[model samples]
Target: MSKPEFNSLNAIFINCTLEKSPRVSHTSRLIDVSKGIMERENVSVDEIRFIDHEVPPGEKPDMTEYGWENDEWPELFKRVMKADILVFATPIWLGDKSSVAKKLIERLDGMSDKTNEKGQAIY
Candidate 1:
């Protein structure tokens, strides 16, 4: 068997650090490791630091009611839609995933029903 091909693959790493202005942290370290692995496979990588952005937490998926035009989530979702792979990088805090990570999941829940071109669920 030959190695799998990933020349056209694109990936996004959502770093869910709690710090508003996160400095070097464990979550970033994990992202670095993943980046190295993906780069070796020729996979394009993009990263998003949720804590650095104004990501308001709510159960609602779209932020239209809260002025979606100015929200960063819509743009982020668009990037996720275009990616072939998504890596959720979050540090476990007190036996739970980081709050930002949970918020990310909640935000994505609204897209769970949507399917990809291959008839697979996007979320």
Candidate 2:
């Protein structure tokens, strides 16, 4: 096995289902479809089931700094940072995405002055 080229396209999919793993997630099935399409195009795809991790809610990049003892977003954010694309998969309820999804979006939006190698803002 060898490292992918620096220019290789990569994507990260965050499944914001409230349901834990070992259980079926229709949204994830939908992600599988998109993942397959990207894979066919030679894109590396990484999947993260958000519910399985302990990511507290906060506007800061790291909730731990905001008095949280444990925040998984820092580690998760690393994955988000490394990807060329981020696909957030969320289940809709009453015509709105799940709370978890909303929180995730907020966190992403709250991203501070971090930019990619191209000098483009990552949000």
Candidate 3:
């Protein structure tokens, strides 16, 4: 079989640092390294610092009740759906993934049954 052909490969790096403001995060730096590798391969890269956004913790995929598509998590999910690769970068905290990282996973879990325009599973 031949290798898959892609016009462009998009990657999203979800940085799950606990910092509340725009502070330098080690997790983000690690993502930068990975991003550089992807860039060398001609893949578009996008980074999202979870701590910088007000993403609430829940199993609801889209935040429609709270003003549909107005929440950051849903907007971020949109970007994730369009990407070919996804990287979840987070610093280990107390022998476990950061709280923000766990929360992001929970939010994404809600989209496990979602489908794309072509009726393919987004997860």
Candidate 4:
């Protein structure tokens, strides 16, 4: 069998900063630098600021099914599943990752069992 072709890679950068858009986020700036380098190598990049969206906290694939009035995790998760690379950008708080970062991680754990078309675990 022939080897699989590697045309390009898709990356999703999830900024888990506490601050919203238009606000200064050191973590986000760092992500931008990395994003530029990846783009130079022909990688398709997508960014998501966790704070800007209303993503209710829950340990499930879709929080809406868990009684959340609205959830953005499902949509964001879709992007994550489609990407070849996942980048979480968050500032260190008290020697630990930010809350947004933790939340994203937990939410991701909800889908830890997810697999790609080839049945390989996404994580």
Candidate 5:
């Protein structure tokens, strides 16, 4: 079979389900939305990036060394840099996005355009 054409629709799913929030249900709902977009657009999806903010016991999740790419360091920024469109779907916690989502947002510093004084994206 021929390989499918790759179209851009970058997706980021962040789980912010406090300690008792229903996470999977919310995420499933978001997935349905993404699927609907894909079906409506008639474009092939290249990738879906899912970031789980819920950490394991005694472990810190950092973009620099998240173990997703071994101990080589720096993976999240690389992925973000390649995405053409970003979709951030996160559960609300304490009336705000989860800390994991916030961390992911902070990591966006590496992808900044660096032209604007306020770091407004030029791309």
Candidate 6:
């Protein structure tokens, strides 16, 4: 069978933090929101994404490459760009967006201007 067309259905929920004490871990709140969205949309009707951000400082324990650019980051970016809708779930820290979400957004800024070998933005 042929592969599904891009953007047929896609969504992402990136939680910035979930530390618990700090006004509740942002990830925890995001998961609740994500679950509701998935339920409302129905499991068979749409695709749902949940990006869990819960890691200690320094290199990512799940990482298996020299750097993110050479590893999962690329694939994750592709997924995000392919999505029809993107949701950024984060908490306010010191009256500002959580650092994790901020960094992810910053990383995504370059996606729009990029092009594939055939010259196509992921969006």
Separately for all candidates shown, the number of backbone clashes (residues 3 or more apart, or on different chains) is 0, 0, 0, 0, 0, 2
**Best model per lDDT:** 4
TM-score of 5: 0.50
lDDT of each: 0.82, 0.87, 0.82, 0.89, 0.47, 0.53
Q: What are the per-residue Cα lDDT tens digits for candidate 6 across 1-123? A: 985443345655555563543355545665676757665654222222223432222233223343433334555665566656666766676888776666566556645577778887755
Q: For model 5, how does the per-residue alpha-carbon lDDT over 1-123 read when each residue is reduced to its tens digit?
A: 986643544443333333343444565576567757765665443332334322222123343354443321145444544555555656676798766456556545433544446767634
The lDDT ranking, best first, is: 4, 2, 1, 3, 6, 5
lDDT of 2 by residue, 1-123 (tens): 985553488899999998899788899899999999888778889999998998888788888888989988888998988898989999998899999998888788768677868998765
The true-structure Cα RMSD of candidate 2 reads 4.7
RMSD of 6: 7.7
What TM-scores do the predictions have? 0.83, 0.85, 0.83, 0.88, 0.50, 0.55
The candidate that wins on TM-score is 4
- TM-score leaderboard ranking: 4, 2, 1, 3, 6, 5
Instruction: Give me candidate 3's TM-score against the actual structure.
Output: 0.83
Q: Which of candidates 2 and 5 reaches a greater lDDT? A: 2
Clashing pairs in 4: none
Clashing pairs in 5: none
What are the candidates' C-alpha RMSDs? 2.4, 4.7, 3.4, 3.8, 8.1, 7.7
True lDDT of residue 10, candidate 3: 92
